[model samples]
Target: MIFSVNSKVLEKVLSKVYPAVPTRTPMPILENFLFQIEEGKLTITATDMEITLRSAIFIDSTDNAEMVVPAKLLYDIVRSLGDTLIQFQIDIDNNKMQLSTDNGTYNIGYAASSDFPSIPNVNHDKKFSLSAKQLKKALDQTAFAVSKEAIRPAMMGLLFEFNIDGLRFVATDGHRLVRYSLLSEKSEIPEQYVVPERATSVLSKLL
Candidate 1:
């Protein structure tokens, strides 16, 4: 398969998802980015099993394909290329992928799409929107209070409580605790979810 995209644009998309790639992992596959191209859109995804990040951009491609490529190597290469058009050629037979720009061509080994873990589909039946400012403020107020101890996994995340009064963000280590409330449309049914600390950290940066 062959496709072309602007290096800077691809770099931006990769940056958005790179945080989810763990620095140290027992599973080597988690160190790579899952690249999926369908129709004319290219999607890049990375996950450390605990959290997943994905970003997409339109590109010039005549075929559909999926492969896993080394995340750090690819991102670093694209970032150094400056503004240029990059042509990608995937040699499935040899399990190799080549990236070519006006200045140079680079080759990196790739793995079959099946080797990458599948990303779970999230159910969006009930959803709400929060401005970046509001979300960032809430995270700033509560993230510090989350527990660092591994004994209790539940306290390592922030509690999201939705009720009649409003939505409350709560976090607690064994001693200190914080609760921040934001007034919004009241929900008839109260709900609670514990968002992992790693996920919250990455989300704050993105916002």
Candidate 2:
């Protein structure tokens, strides 16, 4: 498969996904990004088991392919390059991916897409949207109080509670606690979810 995309554009997408790649893992496969190219779009995904981040961009490609490439290595290389066109050449038979630019050509080994874990499909039947500013503010207000202690697993993340009163963001670490609510809208169904601290931290930067 072959495809070409702008270096800066690819860098931006990588930045959003790379945070999900685990810094240290017994499963080395978790340290790579799942690259899926189909039709005219390129999708990049990374996950640390608990959190998954995926981003996509349109690209000019001659064929479709999927492979897992080292997240840190690929992101570092792309960010270091000056704004230029990057042509990607995938050699599936040899398990190698070649990236060529105006000044340099680089090659990186890749694993089969089958080796990468499948990303869970999120159900969107019950969904709501929040402006970036509002979401970021909530995260900033509560994230500091989230527990870092592993013994109390439930308190190690942020709580998202949805009810008729609106949505509430809660975090506590025994001594410190924070609750931020947005009562602009109401929901008939009351639901709650615990978002891991890693996910919240990464999401804050993206917002």
Clashing pairs in 2: none
**What lDDT would candidate 1 get against the real structure?**
0.92
TM-score between model 1 and native:
0.96
Q: On a 0 to 100 scale, what is the lDDT of residue 104 in model 2? A: 96
Query: Hey, what RMSD does candidate 1 come out at?
Result: 1.2
Count of backbone clashes for each model?
Answer: 0, 0
Clashes in model 1: which pairs? none
**Model 2 C-alpha lDDT per residue in residues 43-120, reported as the tens digit of each score:** 999999988999999988857899999999999999999799999988999999999998999999999999999988
lDDT of 1 by residue, 83-170 (tens): 9999999898998999998899999999998999999999898887668999899999899999999998989999988888888999
Tell me the lDDT of model 1 at 82.
Answer: 98
In model 2, where do residues sit more than 4 Å from their true spots?
none
TM-score of each: 0.96, 0.96
Give the alpha-carbon lDDT of every model: 0.92, 0.93
